[model samples]
Target: MIKVVKFGGSSLASAEQFKKVGDIIRKDETRRYVIPSAPGKRTPKDTKVTDMLYHCYGQAILANDDDDCEEYQRSFEDLIEKIKERYQEIIEGLSLELSLDEDFKVIKENFSKKIGRDYAASRGEYLNGKIMAAYLGIEFIDAAEIIFFDEEGNFDDKKTDEAVAKRLENLERAVIPGFYGSGPDGKIRTFSRGGSDITGSIVAKAVHADMYENWTDVSGFLIADPRIIPNPKAIDVITYRELRELSYMGATVLHEDAIFPVRKEGIPINIRNTNSPEDKGTLIVEDTCRKPRFIITGIAGKKDFASITVEKAMMNGQIGFCKKVLEVFEDNGISIEHMPSGIDTMTIFVHQDEFEEKEQKVIAGIHRAVEPDFLELESDLALIAVVGRGMRATRGTSGRLFSALAHANVNVKMIDQGSSELNIIIGVRNHDFQPAIKAIYDIFVNTMI
Candidate 1:
């Protein structure tokens, strides 16, 4: 069976880390394709190679624009040396006879020419991919050659899949850098941060791998944010639908975009810990027949949302009422997070940051569009999602959730649940976010113990 493995920056931060990764790959011959990120922080205080590249590139841009940029030039040269030293140390530690001198020369020239930030950011993965390929004695495939983006900078999925499948057809083992691809103009373009996960997923789909292993520092995804619930229980297996709900609520073990490609192909993704390779970690799949160990798979949430409540008589009977309300938000360029409505009451939840500046305009728009009996706006709200497939089979899950919050003295401002019974969302004051999560964790996870 073929496996596609992607290692995060922390897993490949130093020579020792690289050695650990080498062993992990060598142990599994079926792991034919490898994806590597740029070197991450070596220590808590250390800087990531990607950040350093950005800094260096920024300095280069300043030097080109300003005639009196001697200081910026010096700083740029220093950063370049520092980046080189980082690679040199890894090469020495691994005792590999590889040279990046020519690559650096080309990079330096490109930087001086004011190459795009995407190009600058992608260097980390490119440099690391070279080292990884050399150390493994495998072919190095540049991601730009296979991954494709359109003129508008949107990822061209069909083109990318076709290119990757054709390119890897003849290769037995190869190392491809993550986070970057060539646009229609042949210029480098990058995804938002944490894009390497998306790259790994794309590769897994193209090759139709049996499993995609994502190695990182953590053992697996936890049922609750560790910060909220100390040493929270780990989720052993999670369905893609459950993961999406949790991710949307702020759970971040895997990139949200990463789920789509592999999900369509029905390939399972294993979240493994590189530091502790023996751990089974979390297995994310499209669907599963195995029952969840807990009544809830995970609890995740975010703070600082604002809610607008519109009250109107005979609202349920009014045609185009909800549509008009939604159109106001759409015209104002504000996305609604959740809208839970009753017979005459409808509440719209949105990120506070997105709605704060345009509040008055939206209020006026709503007044003109819906002509509600009363309208009220409230801020400083947080939404927590209790998601699990087991929730459907278990009775009184919502009752237990309300009980937990009431016992914790956390006021619930709003509650919404999807028809699928896959997730229940509760909105509370920002300050009660932690306590609310703790209470729910105790009810669903700790009580089971």
Candidate 2:
């Protein structure tokens, strides 16, 4: 069985880390295609190679106009040397007869020309891929050749898939840099940060691999943010839909968009840790017949939300009432997060930062469109999503949730559950966010255990 493995920056941070990765790959002959990210922070205080590239590029941009151009040039040279040293250290540690001199010369020339930040950011993965390929004695395939983007800078999925499939079909093993592709103009373009995950998924789909293994610093995704819930339980297996709910609510391990490409092909993604290869990490699949271990799969939440409540007698009776109110938000370009309603009241939840600038306009639009008798706007609200497929089979999940919060003296402002019974959302005051999560976790995860 063929496997496509993608290693995150932390997994390839240092030569020591690279040694660990090399062992993992060598042990698994089926792992033919490799995707790698730039070197990440080796320690808590260390800077990432990507960030250093950005800084160096930024310095190059400013050197053109600086009064002390000579000094600025010297600084730029220093930064480039540091980046080379990072790669050189890895090469020396791995005992590889590889030289990145020509690559660095080209990169320095590009930086001098101010060839866009995307190009600057992409060099991290590009350079790392070269090192990875040499260390493994495998062919190096530049992602720009296989991944395609449209003129608008959006990924061209069909083109990318077609190109990647044809390119890798004949190759037994290759290393493709993650996070970058070529646009219509043949200029380098990058995805948002942490896009290596998306690259892995794309390669997995193109190759139709049996499984996609994502190697990172963490063994797997945790039930809750470890910072919020001390030593949170690790999720062994999660479905695509369930992961979406948790990711949307703020549980981040895998990139949310990464699930799409593999999901369409019904490919399963195994999130593994490089440091602890023996431990089986979280498995993300399209669907599963296996029952969840807990009543709820995971809980995640976000803070700084504002709710606008439109109350009018017989409001539910009026046709297009909700539509008109929603249109007002749509017209104002504010994306509504949630809209839970009663017979006479509808509360529109939105990110506070997005709504603040156009608050008066939206309020006025609501007044003219819906003509509610009372309109109240509240802010500093936090939304928590308790998601699980098991909740559908088990009863009193909501009762237990509310009971836990009440016992913790946390007041719930709003509650919304999807028709799928897959997840429940509860809004609480910003201050209660941590406590609310703790209470929910204790009830759903701890009590169940």
The C-alpha stretches of model 1 lying farther than 4 A from their native spots are none
- The digit string of per-residue lDDT tens for model 2 on 13-81 reads 999999999999999999999999999999999999999999999888888668477878888899999
Candidate 2 off by > 4 Å: 66-68
> What CA RMSD would you report for each candidate?
0.8, 1.2
Best by TM-score: 1
Assess the local accuracy of residue 91 in candidate 1 as a C-alpha lDDT between 0 and 100: 94
Q: List clash counts for every candidate, in order.
A: 0, 0
**Candidate 2: residue 48 Cα off by (Å):** 0.6
Candidate 1: give the clashing pairs. none
In Å, residue 371's CA in model 1 sits off its true spot by: 0.9
